[model samples]
Target: MHGRQLCVCVCAAWFLAANGEDVTCLSEYYMGREGFRSVPLSPLVYTPIAHRPDWYWKKIFQMRGIDPESVKSGYTEAWLAFLFVEAQEAMTVCSIEGGRYWDCILDVRKVYDLAQGSARSTFAGRLAAVFGITLAAPDPLPGHLRLSLCAPARCTESQVVQEIFPLAVDMLMGERPQQMLGNASFRDVVVAHEVAGWHDFDIDFAIVGVNRCGTTSLRKNMELHPDVVIKGDEEETILSYELANRLLPLKAQVEEYNAQVQERITAKFKATGHRPHIVGIGNPLLFQSALVRQKLALMPQLKLVLAVCEPVGRMEKIFMMEKYCHDDLPAAQKRLVAWPYRDGSEVCFPSTSALLTERHGQLKLFWDQRIATAQHLAALAELFPSRLFVLHQTELRDTPSNIFNELAAFVGLRPFPEKIVFRRYNSVGGHRTDLCFNASLVRSLQRLLEREYVMQESILQAFRGIRIAARSTRCDLVDKVDTTYCPNMAC
Candidate 1:
């Protein structure tokens, strides 16, 4: 019989015996129809037209109570059809093959294994084994017999076939194409798999700054906006650290860091019709050059937000928090004594008189160096002139709405909806003043502020000079103007 006639005879016999219903085979039915050509299995190049035969074969298999996905060769439409017809004949239609189709099926499967360069144990193989039939070793077909019904060329060399039924192929083969065998490199595959099933996005903005200076609150308020997606509650410290250290390849590191974040932001985008204009993460320690350089390299257009506060208040809050956590005064004093200073100077726990008189200037310098103020912000501004946004911690606390509006404009986001309410989050509740430090320590910190006046003024003067120069150029003054000196100090 001709190829189409043989296929129809086999399919009709299998269907009648298996399902007790007479259905015309797809190839035979469409043989003479216009624009309908049977997909040739001998050459085995999977094309879009091959789906028609695969769909018909799936229906037949489903009618016979077999899951197409459970079959090993189900990925290739032609091979799956051959397996289905052969397995049906061997198991159910004994009259057609005279109780010998089991051997025939094995012969075909061996050819398939040889062509594909791998052996796949199938449901059909298990069934044949139950019938006490042992499959012969895979043998190379003779040249004259190579184009037989069990031809090797019918199953190999076409990834398009594997892609057609990916889930079944992945399940059977125990690997995904995108994760293991795609044309893309291993790194590309890994990155693609990490961000799979989500919309792609980039980190557009970041709030990088002082830890106790309302960064958490700012992040919370920003998330309330329709166009913003902030990934975590506080700092993504490890990611920032990795960026700073170059601990891994840049692309791999970024993908690892942002994979979960992208999923979260994508979920937000799906829930609301609004796609995020700004997706961000915050880490207070990102002010370091290494971290900043990596961030700018990845996204040169990234907008940066920093929060500033009165240096003494910031230091006091930190100290009070530490004191409250560790009640052992002597241990706390020891830790302070051992604390590494940027300038490589050590602070000894001082007596009240010593702090009040002689050691005062030394303590003041230590506190000043620890405070990231005008000098640090100015350096950041120089590097990111158009991108840096500075918010005073006091203003953010007092006038949140206005500050948020300005922040929105700076990051190129739409104004927050009037109905959206902003709530203070991660606030250090209650008074830090009630947490008493040693009287001498308080005096020492106060004096430290007093002594840093000249240096602070010089830094502020430098910032003002930049601001004045910026006014003449393209720089927009979005940062909060902080000209007023601290009331406790002489300006």
Candidate 2:
């Protein structure tokens, strides 16, 4: 466990129990002794239940859009099965007496609160209902109130990690509490159909983002091992294609494109099962849209990893990279498309400056979008805190070697066998960093990035409260601005 986590637990126990809240920890097997306090009429009995029968569950799985036969091939099967087992156990003690609404609501709220470490997305009551916990007489807890209660319940994180984590992962991944139950049931069917296997991976990492953040580089460096097969960039693009269909009514051509993307990704993963490849998808665009996050959640054991850099540098790189990624247009055509810019905004230029500026009302829009990303990361982190690692691009420049090692450790992979080397160069010749970046432009961009970072840091700190403190290492070089303007050449 992280040292900060230990301190948080000690602080919480001292505050809540000391303040007369009857927060009982319940099971010694899972919750241990210290984190929970007791209430009168709270039963001490705990009963564990096996997953539901396969015949009834198979249909339930199909309803949730999972094919039992296909689900067994990936990690999703084991995850769903574990969730079913927990749901069964939770349903048993949903209420103190016989499904008493207030009692059961409190019970489910406490468990999920601590387990999720924050207010669940307006689904606390519904989630309770899934475990057969009903609310009566008392009002359903306000979203924020449930959140406050849940935040403190994070004291039970270690217990959740050890025993109930996989189930919780399924629950969070599901569309609703009841939907999660279905997923759990399907998990059982898949596990039984597959094998009597032991030792499924408890932790896994996902490179999550809004695309163009060096997710590809992160995955490649981390997946150098023969055992690691990171998914091709196109596979991750399937989620985007899915989102595009939902956002805009697709023409037949677009629909065909989406089908191709999905088939390509599905086939790629299906082919890699022969070797125990620690599969990762680099769908950096996933962070931009809420729908993509929801779709990804269903595929359990995903650790959302985000790689962030200075807004200016990231925007600049993104602008440069987009030309290559979407490179069908000729140079003259691309120039024509970029020339008619309103407020200097063009598809070719990184338009993200509008999103990253520090103007008050404008800042809030950026804050909302960033906060949404953080929330997505937070939910995944709550499910598997150790699995989620947010890396900053500055770290790569600072301690490239250690960053690689840390990344290797994070993704459950061994680092490169050859001595890893850090190469420092931009698209423009880069023996010197200053030669590439205009001093005035760099200063302006740095200021903008720092402001944006402060806002992002605030949101991240609020959720996980883990601040990464790494000293930035600087390379000395002469400050000479490059004479070249934007490289107008098409990839």
- In TM-score terms, which candidate is top? 1
Consecutive 10-residue window with the lowest summed lDDT within model 1: 190-199
Candidate that would win on lDDT: 1
Clashing pairs in model 1, backbone N/Cα/C closer than 3 A: none
Q: Write the per-residue lDDT of candidate 2 for residues 270-354, one digit (tens) a residue.
A: 8755353466667676665443443444445656677765454454443333322223345523443222222222233223333
lDDT of 1 by residue, 188-283 (tens): 211111001011126777888766677777777888888888877657654444433221123344566578677777888899977775787787
Each model's C-alpha lDDT?
A: 0.45, 0.40
Number of backbone collisions per candidate: 0, 9
For model 2, what is the alpha-carbon lDDT of residue 210? 34
| Clash count in backbone of candidate 2 | 9
